[model samples]
Target: MVAADRNAGGIRGQKAVFVGPHQLLRPLGEGGMGQVYLARSPGLRLLAVKVIRPEYAEDPQFQRRFQQEVEAARRVTGFHTPPVVDAEPRGRRPWMATAYLPAPALGEVILRFGTFSEAGVRALGAALAEALAAIHAAGVVHRDLKPGNVLIARDGPRVIDFGISRAFDATHLTRTGMVCGTPGYIAPECIVSASVTSAAADVFSLGCLLVYALTGRTPFGSGEPAQINRRVVYEEPDLSGVPGTLRPLVASCLDKDPARRSTATTLLGALAPVDPGALLSPGLLAELDARERQAEADLAAPQADPPALPVRTWQSLSRRGLFGLGAGLGAGAAAAVGVPLLLTRRTRPTGSAATVGKPVDAWGVDAAGTGSPPAGPEPLWSKPITGMTVDHQLSLLGATPVWWNEGMGAVGYDGTTGRQAWSREDAQFFQVQNDLIYGTSLDFAGLVWLNDKAESHRSPLVVPAAQRDEAAMSLRVFGADSRTVVLARETSLTGGGIVAGADLGSGAVLWQQEITENLAVSLARHQDSMLSGSGSSMGLVADGRCYFEDSGVIHAVDLRTGASRWQATGVTSAGVPSRLLRTGGLLLVVHGLAVVALDPATGQQRWAAPATPQPIFGCALGAGRLLLSGAMGTAYCLDVTTGRGSWHTTVGVTTAADRGADYQAPSAGEGFFGVPLPSRPSGVAVLDAADGAIRWVVNSASDEGRWTTAAKGGTLYCASATTLRAFRAGGA
Candidate 1:
């Protein structure tokens, strides 16, 4: 038996000290994008760093795209892929780091241990299925899901290397003429059309990956790349040597037609019947068992050299829990990584983690069915949050975001629920024309609405502060004089801010000026304008003029004339525009690295200052203080006029850990709760928003499950997968 270090490739000869603060160890491999170095933090936290290759740095286009991709990748929160800890995409070398796993890729495992026995194959299938489920749920497609991408962790299998994934509804980079994926791993649709929906393409790749895992060969075997392409497009998979239990399922995955292929959900259900042990032939199973035992016996044996890639220690690598006897189709995926790391030649039970308690009620109804559903009662009307739904048509198309009339007000639903408890609706007052509700708290002051009607109200419209779409805002208030109504003008798509006014009883005009277009997402306002987001071309201003951005390219626009701003032809690109803010006679713009104070009167740049995680507005001017949040897990207190920082604090994703964590500021109670990551259990943490400081940490064993919280009567109600817990001020 050989030690893992035998193949270290003269690692000692290279300078070993790490370059990052986390101090990852020296790398084992280098690639086109970056080098993969192993390292550890002071507390023995292992990590992998991908340092960008120098040649790629010279290409500005690739650099921008890489930065954007890294940001998008980090936003994906789940257990399947490695999480980003620190990134320096703009640094001299540009690198990103993630938690490291002391495991081998499926490719390495197969090479070292020979081919997988039947049981090992079954477990591998299951793990892959679970990983895909999570990845897809995040609206991302792994484009590449092959053996080399699967990592076998000690406790389970993990999916990694998302360098080429596609986010749903995002931009595409591969030119029309170029091929985008590994040959064998490419789906038939991708190979044939080069343009398939993200979800469909991924399902196709899953099938191809399963074939390789089960038989140690691609469904379309070794051949010229061109020949393989032809075979993949025309041929039926040859499943000659695959274990019987896995043959049928693997066959379905290989369907030439993408629609005919089984969905991940369906595949997971299909994997249930196969016993992990049955996938292997009897003789091979016996041989593997013997080899595992022998390998263990030899762990202590002295060796002259690290064995080549293919060597196996028969004694030490037992095939016990590794048997995966009952693992279903998902088992193969799980087994592919889970078994290798988990079994450790030792026996342990293997099954999905106890369904995290009676499976979170898919429907909001409780055991009694009478408890309040999170969204509140059957709505007088219903509207979905902009980014909440999986369906994009709700926003891209002219779908009406429903507004409900509740008492004197209206609210928005959290999507599917009907109960009034969790639902949030907007209260209206057209009388207060052009006012919309837009704040983080439930206080009346936080609920004002901006009605864009150009006329005065029928009555004196008086209401709290808020920000909502025209439809929702109009329904909330009543205007008297049709002429004096102050409503947001439906000029064109991407129009500037929501202009405010009082509606005159007459149907004529009222006071109106251009509202800023800094942070608007409404299609009704910004329609005619192409979201001018190309390289150096920031998105269009609300009024359809050119705009500019840092991490995002701002579209060139004439500030004085609301005319279309022309840019150089062929300079096509897109980017996010930071909203403009007014501070102390200085017009402030929040770019990627710092807040630049511009002279609003002349459009001149004034002062630029740095900030942490990039400031995203959280609340309108509360007194003189501005509230904001960042990509990092914290919220900030900034001066509304000076563009100065006041305080910062960490907000839990939610009241409960199981509910998942969110960085949005919590409505101040005894303190605010951070939302938890969905994959993690529910717990609560309180912090000072004035200065990023944790006040308390409470573990919520939520019965509602999935870390979620609700506050009422001065107590924070929390729930997890199994238990429900509560916390309050003074730990009451």
Candidate 2:
């Protein structure tokens, strides 16, 4: 469907218009050889129609190349690539029409969201690899497979801009000396000798794409084309921030020798175990859905024909014959046109007059209702924590609040006085467990542990001398008991390196188990890779057992002896697990649609909850209840022991553009649960945990107040972009 031209002011300068049966709405983009437009068919289907520049339209050479692009693109048929709808290569203004997808380019997503996580990168790699495989299977080579050509959509990443792509049998159109492709992503052979460009070159480009996805920067530094081209041909790629799990494969793809690079099929096989759906954030998916709905609505509206010329036809090139053309066309086109640029505009600040008044006293109620609720909502001291720059939501380090700043490590503040308690420089706080805070610091070259007093201890994470010096590493600490701490450590070089039990006091490793197989191996053995889990909670320690997931199996290990106690399967088949919680003698692991509760001692399944329509974002266990917040804004409370639903409620305002996109897991206190309201007049909804009834909504004046909320000690703490505010029961 064609997207409405919201910015169709006027064509700057152009006389002849209209291509075949499509009427041009607005110039989407213009390049030297062609111009793309947002156009509509007679039936009003929206399409992105690329029409060769008038000058090039008349060139027999350019005509053949344009025809080749249409044919090559038509050969790809899947959700990963935009489908060619119609084409008139022999017309007066040769043009090709493809499905119009209203989404940002991968480059734009990277620019806006910064770098993706390891899981996200893996998902992206898998999708692009599958796309490349399809392109190759059709005997076509996408010579220009860079970030700009990849569109991020709700369903998956879509490959576009096949202007330079050609079928294997088509003739090469470029002269010997001309090099093609975006410099930073160009393969070595393309820079050194463009004549030998092959499918491997596309593989090299995929490596560049993966690097850009993991680190906001390209492998080759951006600068003068000559310089970047030189680096692409000679220098080792800069994969500084690329996760270790993917570094080896990415490095192989970027190999200087084309023979060393993996084929699209091989790469797809390697990443097949990764779940692509897990890569997309709810917010982005919601935005994509909104765009699609808007586009559908726009196309459904009546469309008026803009100033246009009559459609002309030529009979020389038939659609079927174009697909059979030999030798393929060279990779050259006018700069890519018709690409959309998204801009966000914020509304003026709303006044505080609409803010919700002080709420009624609702505190001091225990789990069994031994204490009464507060008399009324009372104002607590609003003390600003100093040294906070680029507002980050505060997490609890016990009762003390802690936060991290880029380049500033972690800082903690006293909960009562708001006085600075301690600070750890050069380390970013990851999680808090018991009295120890775990974080990573490149300055220390490994994971570090900080005590409540801010004393630091480094873990013994040694690297082999033969390995690269700057190998990227990540740690997921499950929990720490009296003597042992259970954690999982992964290096990019090896997929899931090790799950170990470490000494709680000295940070010394006690026992470790190596995971030798990659995701591909795991999938081949089990038919599904059980990589899914909560992105936030990896595993949990309870009953002298260390619980964690590996390749779809939940494993229980003896904390003292490091021996495998038992293992249970069927938690998740793909995607990383969402969360692992231990409560009420049950070890719960939420992965994608499945929520399994297991006996902590025997690793036996107690009860498995049925899948939900949307993924569960957060879950809290308290007051004999387990509360879960879904991506679609649904809140569910289940009986903690049986995993049966006790109550379900739709808690917040959701729209097509942002359905449950802003829903965060509710924070549970003794008697109340707090959830952030992301809609207009942003606020926190305080609900009765027992019945799912709204007790009060602490509303803010502006939408900016919808940041993050945390509840503790009958107090609700709200962190906005600009400030942090705390609220308590009235007259507390």
Ten-residue stretch with the least lDDT total in model 1: 323-332
Q: State the local distance difference test value for candidate 1.
A: 0.40
For each candidate, give its TM-score against the true structure. 0.36, 0.52
Q: Highest lDDT among the candidates is held by which one?
A: 2
RMSD for each of the candidates:
23.0, 19.1
Cα lDDT listed for each candidate: 0.40, 0.57
lDDT by residue (1-732, candidate 1, tens digit) is 122333221122211133345443333343324446655544555567666533333234555656766776677666667787776665434567777766656654543345666666666676677667766776667776766577765455678866434421122323123445656667787778765656556666676666665565667754234566777888877788887877778877777777787877787787765454543444444545664464343232232233346634322334221111010001011111111121222112112010011111211101111121121112222222222221011100011112222223332222223122222333332212112222211233222332322111133322223322222322222121223333332221112333334433332333333433322232211211111000111122232122443222233343333233432211111122344433355444443223445454445554433233322322322334444444223344555455555554433221212111222223233334333222233344444334324444444333222343333323443333333334443223
lDDT for position 277 in model 2: 72
What ranges in model 1 sit over 4 Å off? 1-20, 163-176, 195-197, 273-732
Clashes of each: 187, 28
Give residue 436's error in model 2 in angstroms. 2.7
lDDT of 2 by residue, 657-724 (tens): 34213344467666666666545556666666766655656665643535565566677666665556
